[model samples]
Target: MAGGAAPPSTARGGYRLSALNDDLLQEIITCLPVKEAARTVVLAKRWRYLWPSAPLFLNDADLPQPARDVVVPRVLAEHRGRFRSINLAYFRLASLDRELPGWPRLLADKRTQRLQLTNRNYLPPNQIGTLPHIPADILRCGSLQNLVLGFLKFPVDLSHGVEIFLPNLRELTLAMVIISGEDLEHLITACTALKTLKLTSLTPKRVHLRSRSLRCALVGLSRVEDFAVVDAPLLERLVLYLPGTGARVKIGYAANLLVLGHLDTRVHQLQIRDMVIKSGLKPNTMASTSTLIPSVKILAVTVNFGVLSELNTLASFLRCFPNIVTLHIESVLHDPSVSASAIEPSGEHHAKFWQEVGPVECLRSHVLEKMAIHEFRGDQDEFEFLKFVAMNAQGLQSLHVVLQEGDTSSSDDKKVNEAREKLQDLRFQTGISGVLLVLPKEGILSTLQKATDLTYNDPFRF
Candidate 1:
């Protein structure tokens, strides 16, 4: 009476997938893609009830489009067990007007722990008249531990204190979410258990950090004039990447702050404690211990080697962190339109500039051990800087030179070999033989999102 003979598992030496217990089967089903997970019901008689019984892990992106409208609602409605996580990033707010109202309540009732809702195909705020705001009730979901929202407007009433509390939330990432500065601050404070926060492409006049639980924060590509850390006792890493015009960074009472940067000399003006870093400030003018932030062991900065003033400014910046052991330098290309005074002479003149720049404290103190130069183009100015660091950073153990990818010059075998040879000569002369590494630019070079990720200690290293 067996249908179509016994399954292959019926053989003496074969194993049966259906033999696994319900709990294990459900867990395995949860690991599959949403659509594939749903298809498990047809595998065997035991799996008929498994898909609906397992906790839901639904991602609209996982399902092929053209039918997401029908599939999403059906799954949400039919699933009998708790909701584990839900990501609805493929639909615009206007298209989900009717269904959106019920989502927050359903997610809350089903105990969803992680939720990401984004508005797809949304235009920039300036180009569009107004964006539809996310349902305010979504903020009331107490079971959420991680939330990522993008291309939507936060509730306008948040600034007026309409009672927002996310006591269990741990990680929050907001990208292109239109919200006022006060509301952003209010929302951040409401999350009493927040640990990691990332904000990108959102303009707030000023961002003031005053959180006790926050550890790592990244703000990138935003038009924020001032980023002030009023008080973050537990904060460790603060990364600011591609900041807009007139951006100023002020650090206040971040006692545990260790990792910082991509501090661009052309854009940002940094102020740590009472010390203000500025051009024309001599690096050798450190008369008091209070002027330096010695606790910072890792630093990343953007420097344009062609700019004479930027190099001088970078020298001053480096002197502020005398104990930094790891340094990351991103060499930006020269802008032909930049003021003539900022552009320095090339070839021999650049070598002369580095020679006269005096001893960088971190390099001479025998504390610097690791350095990575990104976007290396085998230019004279770059070589001059590398030669200075190699010769002066006596304690340097490793130097990583990352050649620019897809660059015609970087692909030239002769030029690359010449660069390698020169770097090898410098290494041998400095007694740091076998410490130089020439690498090509590849992979997903670190992003602000990944940089602020709590898992990595030195996000700027790559």
Candidate 2:
């Protein structure tokens, strides 16, 4: 009776329900609601024990008043074979705690791959009690791949002598929960196989990211002042947004890094924008061309600047990327009162012009060919920035200015045309036939969004 459900009914041309085999029929029961699966008992003797014994998904929060306390453990005691994930609300924890080493112990069993124990009984993301300490048994799970815990005062507080190890966790997401920095560090180091780790909306005392194989790491809106990427040799993509002011991040090493944004860079395809790390005080000139990424072929930056003094930072930034062939700058005007001025190849901080004879190898390199300016406002400062890029690239192929939606009024159109005339006029004399494009935002974003693989033709999308 325990091993087999009643045999499958043979096909009756009159009744189609009789056609499914015992195994197929049992699978259908697993997808049904508990009441519907239980009702299958009345349909035929074959389903008598099937409903209660089917792989269960029980949420103590779903059962009404009195049943919440008693029903889960009663059914789980009788449940045999495999189980799909479990959820327990905060209110039921007190009753369930009495049965702890009995019911909570099931969560540690090898078959449960995903486990979440939180307070859906309280409120949206947090509630009115001490956050639960993760069971020591659940922490030692060798087969658990994804674990999520919510609204705990602290995520985990391992008992003094307990040995907690999660050898196979791949994706771990913790929200609105506090954990001591040392304990959190131990939890991450123990996972060994973690690929994606996201820590959101919690202020830990210290954060030391020392992972060798992490691929995608996102630390959002962190306030931690002492943060360091001690070592992450295999880390490829990272987004670190420390929205809190006065936080300085130090990147020790990410040698194989690619596609880093906002968090700061390690190499090749680098983007620096308004989103890039800010020094809180005025930004000093970007570090030297040698200390910065020497292998970078494309450099993108977002700066909030307005005056001639600020425009100088653009040249200083460009000087650091000698191997750059593609450059992207998004104008973010931080001060409206400040004005603009003409660019000088001989300015104090400006590097040698692309055409100037200089000791530096980049001038002769001819590697800079493409430049894209996004959110072009046609302001005096923005115009001067675009004009400077076109004038400096001796081997320039195309310079694109994608205008913001408001930058296209009738008067704005004339200014845009005036800028275009400068490029065309210079092209005849210089003989560097780089195409100058002033595009509307929608056309380009739509093209890139529609294609994921670099199948689209937009140079910026590359």
| CA lDDT, every model vs. true structure | 0.79, 0.55
Lowest summed lDDT across 10 adjacent residues in model 1 is found at: 428-437
Tens-digit per-residue lDDT, 205-299, candidate 2: 47777776676566654556555556777765455543453344555566654433342221111223112332321333444433454544545
Candidate 1: where are CA atoms >4 Å away?
A: 1-8, 11-15, 42-45, 335-349, 408-411, 427-430, 434-438, 443-450
TM-scores, all models, native as reference: 0.88, 0.62
lDDT per residue for candidate 1 within 398-448, as digits (tens), equals 788877656644348788777778777775234774333455455543565
* Top-scoring candidate (TM-score): 1
